[model samples]
Target: MRIVVCVKQVPGTHDAKIDPETKRIIREGIKVVINPFDTYAIEAAVQIKEEIGGEVIVLSMGPSRAITVLREGITVGADRGILLSDRAFGGSDTWATSYALSRAIETIGDVDLVICGKQAIDGDTAQVGPGIAAHLSWPQATYVMDIADINSGSLTARRMHEDGWDLCAVKLPAVITVVKDINQPRVPTLKGRLAAEKQEIPIWKAADIGADPERLGLNGSPTRVVKTNPPQGRMKKSVVLDGPVEQSVRRLVQELRQRSLV
Candidate 1:
């Protein structure tokens, strides 16, 4: 089994500034960290590798600084890391980002499984993983909570739904987006950290992965953010009442009736 986990480097703070001109988050000078949800995805992939006796490869696409996230993954047991970095990849939306990642996966040759987090915290758009599956024309399961079983060519997983979870079986070479309920991420050991420091992470560009220029970067994105602003704050006030239990109940009911809340 050769499992690939897709990780992302996201702004560590909620107060990250957005570029008004481009309508994208300004990444430079912002504190960066691995997307919190992606840690579960990495945990799931590492667990699968341990059970099946295979290698786990971590893949990330971002600016040159994003290499830190890849190295962090290596420290946590990923056998290898691949960084897709280039100026041309700037301002890519989910669609173009997935297209580029799909191309890179193809370049990596054979892969048994792909896993990713349900969403990135910065964007809060859970689209990239499914987008990658669409580009690869493979089966995908989103919001996965558990891997029930896996063999040589097939896997059974528990997918989270609104009501509960559904068990689904998929062939090898499938993609899955995992939620934080999957598993707890392991801490990097001393040996793993040393190994990661010495590892040479291969970098790829749009051309290296054979991605079409017309289908990559901002130009290829079908959606665009025209503008963004902080949400308005609520200004409503609440009233406090003190009286006997029955009087208090009556007052509450009167307030509800006054506000048409019941």
Candidate 2:
């Protein structure tokens, strides 16, 4: 089984700049961390590999510095890493981003399964995984809480939803996006850390992946960001509780009821 996990480098701070033309985050020269949710995807892939004896390869699409997140995945048990980076990939919306990723996966050859986080904190779009599935024409299950079984030809997992969750089975060579509730991520061992430090990742350009230039970046993206405004500040309301605890609780409940908070 060859499991490819797609990870991302997202801004660490909430203060992010957007390209008004593309409606995408300007990731250049900003402090970044591994997309927090991607860690779970990495963990899930690593765990699956360990359980069944396979390789976990981490993939990412970003600038050169984004390779850091790939290396981080290697330290936590990914076998190797690949980066999809090129000037043409700049300012890609989720659709374009997912298309590039699907092409990268195709370049990697035989992959039994693809895993990713449900969403990136920076974008909060939650569309890339499903988008990749669409581009690849493979089955997809999103918001997966736990994978119950995996075999040579298929996989079964519990998919989470608004009301509840249901077990779903899909054929191999499928895509799935995981939520944070899946598993606890393991820390990188000293040996794994050393290996990650020395790993030389190969960077693939759009041409390298045989991706169409017309569908590579901002030009391929149909969505545009006309304007972006910072979120308005929320007003703080202070409620003072007086007298006994029970009285305070009652008063708070009454206040909440009045405000339709309950």
Candidate 2 weakest ten by summed lDDT? 15-24
Candidate 2, residues 73-146, lDDT tens digits: the string is: 99999999999999999878888999999999999989989999999998899999999999999999999999
Q: What lDDT score belongs to each candidate, Candidate 1 first?
A: 0.91, 0.93
Q: All candidates' TM-scores? A: 0.92, 0.92
TM-score for candidate 1: 0.92
After superposition, the stretches of candidate 1 with alpha carbons farther than 4 Å from their true spots are 236-257
Q: Which stretches of candidate 2 lie over 4 Å from their true place?
A: 19-23, 240-247, 250-254, 260-262
Q: What's the true lDDT of residue 261 in model 2?
A: 98
Clashes of 1: 0
